[model samples]
Target: MELLEGNESRCQNMFWMNKDVFIRLCDELENIYKVKGSQRISVAEKLGMFLYTLGEGAGNRNVQERFQHFGKTVSRYFSGMLNVVCDMTKEFIKPSDPKFKSIPPEILGDYRYMPHFKDCIGAIDGVHVRATISPSNQVPYIGRKGIPTHNIMAVCNFDMQFTFACAGWEGTAHDTRIFQSAIHNLALKFPKPPNEYPQMKWYLGPYKCQRYHLPEFRRGAQPTGYKEIFNHAHSSIRSVIERTFGV
Candidate 1:
């Protein structure tokens, strides 16, 4: 209550978003998701508790102390909030244009990638998220990072919204394997580019063993040849997925 009623900075600091967004989220949860408030607790308080735990990575005890509630109460609302948010993914995390009818504004408006990457639809990449599994079964989930994690493959348009996501793959699984599995799985309904262009390619990758990373070219090492120039442009355009993952 205090956090939401307080200034914008306090709400942003604790909830990881401003007061208006927080209130709007609470409203959406109640109106659309049918989340209800109990006799003693309001919906905003429940949501604030959930956001505090997530934004701070705080444990149940920390949430209990901060929210002034019992451990069980905090656990119940946190789990409820988590489930509600997951359900919302179906509604929010999708391509703005299901048909891929035209080029995205983010790409169309940018002269650097217009003509060259005209056929490019979006970016695809994989990220490793830490996972908790039994010690006996940890080997399969341990990748080059030497940690148990999940390799999540996701596709996002230039606007930085996830159109598709394939999770639950072990960290050791190769990106190609996960990608192939995702495309082959009809149930996933992965978006496919329209056939307007007969020479539609699945994806474009940088030149092999070449200067690709953005930092490499940023340090006064300008791309010299055609391959290096193409790779540099490709990396610059495809960096949206990297930024999305960073967020």
Candidate 2:
């Protein structure tokens, strides 16, 4: 760091911050975060290496050698670093709840959304995530796809942004069940309490409730207006989730 500050640093060694930042961060872990364990290399070193891997995914041995350490598997480093990073970063990266607002009659013309999708609050759908189960269960766990594992329930909006995701549900679970689960598990910070997830806040503008309401979605024959409306909204939101993983 001192050499770099003096303007004598070379391009090859300019990544000195990677080391310095790592050390300082490790100091944070030890002093501020209070991780009480003896380690040869500081938490900073492992962290720097982890950040570097994010830029360029590498094999375990490859990363270990770059860190100037030995016998540390990439698996161990990934497990530790990600566990901490996810815990620290999820609140910031994930999307907040949805809301219900009115839409402008001018924008909708006769239908909704001038010509595009109008009054469409959002779309919601569920997905399947394959898991690696044991021998016997693997066969059944593989839904219609004939693969392995179960399904993950995910939801999104008409604009194609994903608002929520619920993984690890069995494939046999219903879409409404997945919708209910997503709402129940949703963080309450962005939403008002009375209803689980935030309702659309506007009837016009961006807040108009434009749900995807697929025809096949409400299969059980509940036949209620609100249930149908919610199912449609969930369906629309779910369409986005489907397209997301498709990429």
Candidate 3:
């Protein structure tokens, strides 16, 4: 791809003869492969795997073919690159420490609903991501867009920031189930839950923010749902998550 984009030499010069971060990353990777008796593989070959799979999202055989230009030996180099980048991103891309304090709903920016939904901390929803076909009851795995995929649940905050996401569950799972799983894993993988809500910080007005969780509404022992006045505000703000993901 670098070559396709008119930067092939940059890739070769850095990976081949230069000593830099990629080299260090490759050395660190060799140690990782060593546990599996993969010590004999070259750094370049490991890099090839990473480049082929994640960089281009190519299948294994396609990756093997792509490495032919670099000489098959460099394929392992790609694998090293993929592993290092994956490990790095997982550690880095995370939900920022979200304050319970909420902001005005103007962020929706001329979105159908406005101020009434202001106190919402973030929008939440699920989307489908392509996955390998499965053999069991095939219809459930078939997507409305006519593709084979698993229903990946993901959620974004008011800022369109991907605050939560999960992939691997079968499409059969309900939105509520997917949401619960995402939150549980997010809590364990990250920090403690906040004791307050963001809207608590925003000053009240036609555009102030408010947040409500259905589970909270149910468990709080309220025989009725939220108050009639609150019902409109909550629904308006809650739709943000689905809209953000284009669900």
Candidate 4:
């Protein structure tokens, strides 16, 4: 707590946000989740500790020692805060208006893309987030990387901001399979395409994507012709998702 209050840079580094934003986020969490301050630890302290653990990706035992709290207490506050944040996700993350008028001209003006991606809203991809689970449930979560993880599917617009995110799929699950499930369950409502371009409602992605696919270059051979152009443009646009994940 004292460290968080020390300096702006220290606060940001510890909590992954400025002090003002952290306080505001806590207030928002309290408004919806209602965490009352107890004699042992105040709500602010609990939130701070949880955020520190999350930002640093530290283990429960490490956080327990850092905050001078028991391991169970640290884990409890962390889980509570995580649940509250998950519940509030829908309220905070949402797509822009379906009209598609808000798209910037930069995406529309690039010659490599231009008409090919004029209607593209963004890109979608899957990322693996490490997870810890009981032995009985660990089999399903072990990913191709040979680690227990959850395959998180997310969509981001050209501005590099996430418009949608879904988790809980086993890391062993294929990205296409997870995407198919999301579509079948109607869990995501993608923006509607313009009336004149009804067929352009989908976003661009790599060849492995089920909804969109770029031409594949043959083994030991370079791509040529329109396939090359299309793949280049598609890669340029789809880099947004990579940048978002990196951040």
Strongest candidate by TM-score:
1
lDDT of 3: 0.54
The residue-by-residue lDDT of candidate 1 on 132-223, one tens digit each, is 77899999999999999999999988887788888899999999999878777777777767663333355678889889888999996789
**Residue 172 displacement in candidate 4 (angstroms):** 0.6
The residue-by-residue lDDT of candidate 3 on 146-232, one tens digit each, is 766678766566665666556667666676676555555645352223563433243122222433554554566542434533644
Estimated TM-score for each candidate: 0.82, 0.45, 0.52, 0.80
Worst 10 residues of 3 by lDDT: 202-211
State the lDDT of candidate 4 residue by residue for 175-221, as single tens digits: 88877666555556543346634332354444442222234333334
In terms of lDDT, the poorest run of 10 residues in model 1 is 194-203
- Decreasing TM-score order of the candidates: 1, 4, 3, 2
Q: Say which prediction, candidate 2 or candidate 4, comes out ahead on lDDT.
A: 4
| Candidate 2 lDDT, 145-208, residue by residue in tens | 7777456654444445555455666666666666555555536232222243356332112123
Task: Give the winner by lDDT.
Answer: 1
Cα lDDT computed for each candidate against the true fold: 0.87, 0.52, 0.54, 0.75
Stretches of candidate 1 off by over 4 Å are 109-111, 130-141, 146-148, 195-201, 224-226
Each candidate: how many clashes? Answer: 0, 40, 30, 0
